[model samples]
Target: MIPVQRVPVSDRTQVLLTRWTGRVRDAGGTPKAAREQWIKAQTPRKHVRTALESMTRGAVRCMYCDDSRGTDIDHFQPLENAPLRAFEWSNHLLACSYCNSNAKRSQYPVNGDGVCLLVDPCAEDPADHLRLLLKSGLYDPVDKSARGEETIRVFGLNRPDLVKGRQDAFFRACSNMRDWHRLHQDADPLADRLAQALLDSPFIDVVHAMTRLKPVAEATVVGPATIPALAAWRTAHSLSFRVGQPRVRRSAASTDCIDGVADNALASDARSGQVRTGRRNNDEPVISMQNYGLTWTDITGTPRSSAVAYDESSAQDRKADLVNDGCTNVEIVAVRPGKLPEPRG
Candidate 1:
């Protein structure tokens, strides 16, 4: 599962959700009743689904498996126990029917502190808790107590079909990385193409794990110790790989970017009072092929926007397909690197 940015919902939608939650609360009914009321409301349901789909880049891939198209709105906290959060936006996640109905039906387990055992992809980094075995395309928990083990079991992440998909992604990513490395010494344009291809590869999480890069995150700053290899590559290539290099005071609560960014562009943590090293921040460059117009926000809240196609012929073929499908614009942007932050002292 990849990290998804929770975009802001419209005021109209927020108001509708609030009204429904208030109704459920006023009735003091069971979660079943709350769900029944929510299901009956056509407008609010549509708005919520749309907002969740947007988080998935219109592909609506399941937040759990990252393989199938998401067909249900999953409650990160089951509405059965957390009834009051029935309509809470943060509690909602896009999920495929198999992961939702077949595997994780009302199975909300908590640890000793009442903290959830499941990994909320939006709230935590799945990579920290999970690792991908490239050969088998199976997910294993990074540690015994890691939440990924439970998440994988609960979500059926290692099911045969999902494993196959991850396997394909892993092979593609490895091939592209090798190609990039081969062209590196030659200063070949194909190397750049290979990098973009890796960025847009399916099962992006696998690609990230193989490359040791973090996915996108809530914050832009990253530390050198987090991604030493990637930092070294960026330095050798003289490429800036960060999203944005804002110099604001860092807070203790912030997390590193999930998507990779260039080194040293992050602000220093005021709590730690250390001047982190300096590196360039290269924002993500996008290559979109959508039926509708591209409308999405970036880490910098900038409007607008790749794959491995370094040659003109292959690039043209992809662009042609987009144009035939009614895509009007074709823009290519740079990508940044990111790594998990070190624990604060």
Candidate 2:
């Protein structure tokens, strides 16, 4: 299982959910009964499903297995017991029918302290509680008290099919990383394609392991310096190396400026007496030229920045340019006219 970040739901959807729950309360039925009743309603049901799909970034893979498509919405706390939270957004998670109906059907066990035994993938990092056995393609609890054991047993995470799938994903990711290392410089286009494939592949934990293990030296075509270059690339593109979670998407204002080309250019212009400022009237709107730059990390932990643009649209254009150049985790931020605060050295 991987960690999933929750996306904000639209107010319209929130109102619909609130109204549905209110109707359930008015009927005086159990939460489970209410769920059954409401799920049969086509419009609201579709809205909830569409919202869930968007939250999962359109992959809509089962939160428990990450292997199968999520076909149903599973209540984190069983509706029979926690009726009040039945329609709570935080309590709903996408699950495959197998994991929902067959494996974890209404089983909500608690520990001695009354803490729930199941791992909440959204609230907790699964890697902290579970460790993947690369050789066996099986999941094991990090320790005896870790909730991973109960989660795996309840969700059937180590089932034969899942184990086999994980193994295949692991091998495929390793092979691709090796190819990426070999062709990154001479055949960059192909390498970028391989990088994107690795990014989009299921079971990203396996891909992250490949980067950490640095096993590309075993490839017959690799050289002594390949490991360092690979490491550098990985550092530059830390966003791509993230395992067990979706890539972090920062707002344009919060994104880091990688290259200083725009800043340096503006500084050079100022030094060369190219910049001029004047106010025609007290209330005249300032027409200062603002520059925006596209910034993103590569596979390695290096910061990359683009040339400055005169407007936000130009910044978006620069972002597209980076995308066309095979960049991932790209963002456009204002770099000049109104310079963003710089990080303390």
Candidate 3:
């Protein structure tokens, strides 16, 4: 996962946000307050502009497209419909203009079961429900929930260019890992070796993906024993992650995050080209486990709900409400997983 690093806010920005928060609360569903907030936030320009710059620092590329560098502030929650959450610090995300405009426009999903596919960088572990199509480049939602469909639609996951980019990245990363493994076929000190192997790549997401792809029955990178087990880590933990200015959601007609599969995913396998050349040891199917931010539970057969972060009673009530709104399943990903794991040695 690409790590996310938070930029320390300047006193000027902090002061502005503090006041903005209060103003939004006071406005509380008033059209006038919402308009006033947008005007004030945009007037100086520097506040929003600088915030976008700060958030994209160390950012790899568009989180959705993974092609061009992301350069704008994205509203994690579409601001038009949920103005109350307009200025929340955690709600703003840095994104590329293509993704900001062409792909993800305020489209978030709610399932009949109350599962929201709109990933909260603060709450959800993206790897859980979503998977990047290595060949297709589109981000596919494995579960058939409203959240999944909406997120895919809004993010333009199936865009030809975007999916192709992700597919290229996957192969590039995979090729590097495979080459390293071939070189150290007889290495020792399993844990030390695994650590070094991981350190070789600056991109941890690549490492996680490689780990998931490694031959399951094989040993360490070199021997019969595999390297020490690496726990699931979120892309948000990366030092590269950042925040940006708030966005106002325009009408759905102007929405960039639209429905329908992009041409990439639908492309015939032969048309996309085969996986990059290398000795891919295993054709064995590898199963990916979802890291639901500790707050998620399997309720397929059971009716019990588990609290991931907030109070149990409130969480259930919220889940029910989300379900009522058309979310078929509700999985409350914990925003804060208590203490984050320290960087591994």
Candidate 4:
């Protein structure tokens, strides 16, 4: 997920929030009764939602999935779990209904040490722990941070429809950038439309990720057509040097860390057209005996929940045990070194 830039609420709204926060924190009711009441309120409180939507990217999309239009104010810290922050401005987030109610709901997991497991997009960059593989349209942990795995599992980030949405948006964003670059000078209106289309589309992170690709890597993976467009896009975002700005040469360290991991060559499939092309390195199915940053599908074969662990025996032995337990198609995937699950706090 891209880092969220939060804007401040009006002074009047801020006062109202202060008063509301006190009431909610002091309210004595059944479990989350006070929170539900606060959520359903109209006057004064409605301003909170309007203010949040303005902070969202691309047609007010969900901050979590960054796809669907946001329709709910998700409490970053669940209202039930951390009631003190119930009406606190910094504790609320813009979210889609599916992500708020279905994907996450009131489930806020913490490690043994009581550290919150879910990544707070507003407070920290998710890329610090997780990296989205643009080609695979799946997320992998940058290191062995449990927060990344927990966030992915909590959001069901690798579900099929979302992955396909990212995959489709990836190509469409490039095409939009290319079109905008070609017509920018001569056809102002059409160029503006092209740029707006790219901005309004879902999976904006995909566009941002593409623009951050290193020069040589971009040439090898993304076709040459989008190079200039990528440059313009980067300039617009203040990520690249403009005409008057001094050129700042970035080392490999800074360049790669632009999004999450360093920008490098990762493979794309042969089915790709001139838009992008590469021979994929790892595309096989894998299952682990411990949680992995690589997403795992459920028994129905749909991308969904937490990873499963088999016996820590030999690969054949693990496969045999899974088969004996009625998982005939299963294959054992060992957790590589430096990729182990983060120990619970």
Off by over 4 Å in 2: 57-59, 208-345
Better of 3 and 4 by TM-score: 4
Clashing pairs in 4: 256-262, 256-263, 289-309
Ranking by lDDT: 4, 2, 1, 3
lDDT of 3 by residue, 188-256 (tens): 113223333343333334444444444562243323322322211111111222233122111111111
Model 4 reaches what TM-score against the true structure? Answer: 0.65
Per-residue lDDT of 41-105 in model 2, one digit per residue for the tens? 45556655665565442256787888778999888888787765565556778899999999999
For candidate 4, give the lDDT. 0.59
Q: How many backbone clashes does candidate 2 have?
A: 14
**Tens digits of per-residue lDDT for model 4, 87-152:** 666677889999999999988999999999998776666777778777778877778789999898
Best by TM-score: 4
Question: Per-candidate TM vs. native?
Answer: 0.59, 0.64, 0.49, 0.65
RMSD of 1: 15.9
TM-score of 3: 0.49
- Deviating ranges (above 4 Å) for candidate 4: 29-33, 185-189, 238-345
